[model samples]
Target: MTDWKKIRAEFPALENWIFLNTATFGQLPKRATEAVACHFARRDRYACSDFMGWFEDADSVRATIARLIHAAADDIAFIPNACTGLSLMMGGMDWKPGDRIVTLEDEFPNHYYYPGYLAAQGVEFIETPFERFYDAINQRTRLVALSMVNYSTGFRPPLEEISGFLRERGVMLYLDGTQGLGALQLDISAIRPAMLSVDGYKWLLAPTGGGFIYVDSELRRHLRPNIIGWRSHRDWRNHENLHHGTPEFGTEAEKYEGGMLSFGPIYGMAASVEMMLEIGPEVIDERVMQLAGSVRDILRRAGGVLRADSDSLYISPVVTARFEEKDAGVLAHELKSRKVLVAARHGNLRVSPHFYNDETDLERFEAALKQVL
Candidate 1:
């Protein structure tokens, strides 16, 4: 059984304010903060001598992340952020002149504009309405990029269905999982996209500037690493070849990790992910969905129009709502003044709840909305 009240105590930020902004940046637990401090302390004491130990810790973090998403650690590569991973894949890899990429109209800028950048190079960019996203694919479509959950609306597309459709067409599916990875249960085996990237700060409860990318084993063999560094090679430690212009690349996802990782955030990521794992994804998903459902219900009762679709299968922890007459920005500001934090995106108020939030938080949010809106 989960001691949710005790779990909530681990996040000190919850004491002063009602945080509903996990969609923007998650509140780090004490464990994550302590882990970062410990990392810095060790680095301050031992300096470069702790470098190998950092690698060892990173490897463990990779394994933990892989376990979270039901993926193999060998397939995971640490990247700075989701955009960098996608950029590396799109820009670094070879693409034919006539290759087409399909994307959703409501996708985040990274998914929208990165493919558009390829348009100047003769690649065809096809953006269809969110409902028609899957139908936009054809024989010429080389890749279909989308977010697992729409950042603006919190609309979750049926990844398994879309991936299956793409698989039949031999087209690659690229997914940005920053919005849904930690708060929801993601079984990669059920929806095996060719490539997937996640920003750890938003949902994984880690510090900013830390995330990962996963390239399917078969796809990794075909991708050529454009961003290469000393660490990209199998014989990375060979001091004699360090200054040489020519070097052999590793045959795995590590080849794409250009250089030394951002260790501070990674240490936090490892600790936070370990806490999440100890709590269990299934438990987290259940609690998040329940809290989000309550939030939606209370907002509706408080005269807020539900903007996000509460699809039975794909509903996540993010709940977006709009007031009939009030502006989203004004409402967000009012909530902030009352210490009920939320995000205003595309004229909708987005409330993302994590496991730390409780009924009292929801009550405060509803009361604030009633008073302000």
Candidate 2:
């Protein structure tokens, strides 16, 4: 049994604001902040004395991330952000002339930008409505890329069914898991996407610049490294022997990492990942869903318009409610003035609660909504 009170103590920011914006960015725990501080302190003490130790910490962070996603440690690579991962996957692919890439409408810019970058190489970009993504896959389609949860509407798609359908047709599937990483429970092995990327700052409670890319072992062989660096090689210490030509590419997905990795963010991320491991994702998922469900029930009783279907089980932990007469932007600002933080996206208020939030936070938000509406 996970104690909400104990979990709340880990995050000091919760004491200040009723944070319902985990979908935008999570509040970092005190321990994670302290870890980064300690790392910087060590750097000041002896600048280059512990150079090897820093790399070891980075490797440990990679292993922890791998465990969280149920992927082999070698199959995960740390990237600066979700966009970097998307670029690596999209640019590395061998797209033939007229090869089609399918994505959803209102998709994140990177989804279009990366594919658009490939368009310069003669690849075709196809944008389809969310309801028709399944039917959009055809023989010319080489890859199907989309978000697991829509950031605007918080709609969680049927990943299992979509992946299965694509796999049968020999099409590659890629997912941007930013909106549903810590808030939802997922088994990467079950969905088996060709590649998946997540930004830890949003839902994983880590600092910015922390994110990873997961490349399926089978798919790794087909991907060429777009951005290469010394660290991407197996033996980065042998930099003096660069005359021997680019070090043999790593057999695993680590080959995708480019240049020097940031140690400060890795230190902070390690702390956050440790806390998640201690509490367990299953418990976190249950608590977050319960809190979100409670908010949904209250909104329904208030007769607000819900963008997502009521029967949808895969709804993102984030919930958005539309107002009939009142402006959502005005209501969002009103909620913020009352110390409740919610985001206004696509004319709806996006309320995302983490495990640390309890019934009190929910009631406070509801009360604020009533006053504003």
- Candidate closest to the true structure, highest lDDT: 1
Q: Taking the tens digit of each residue's C-alpha lDDT, what string does model 1 give over 1-373?
A: 8999999999999999999999999999999999989989998799768587788788888899899999998888988789988887798668888899988776798987788888888999988876677677778899888888888888888888888988988998899999988899999989999889999999889899779998898888888787888787777755455746676776768778968889899888888889989999999999999999898888788777775544553356778878879999999998899998999999888999998999999988888888997
Model 1, which residues run further than 4 Å from truth?
239-243, 308-314
Clashes of each: 0, 0
- Cα lDDT tens digits, model 2, 1-373, are 6678988988888898998889889999999999999999999999868877887787788888888878788878887789888888888888898899999887778889878888778999999986788788889999988887778778787889989999999999999998888878778998999999988898888899988889998888889898987766777756566434565777878788867777778889889988888899888999999998898877777778886565473366879888889887898899889999989887877888888899999998888888988
lDDT of 2 at 331: 84
- The model with the greatest TM-score is 1
Q: Please give each candidate's TM-score.
A: 0.96, 0.96
Give Cα-based local distance difference scores for all models.
0.86, 0.85
Residue pairs clashing, model 1 = none
Estimate the lDDT of model 2: 0.85
Candidate 1 Cα lDDT to native: 0.86
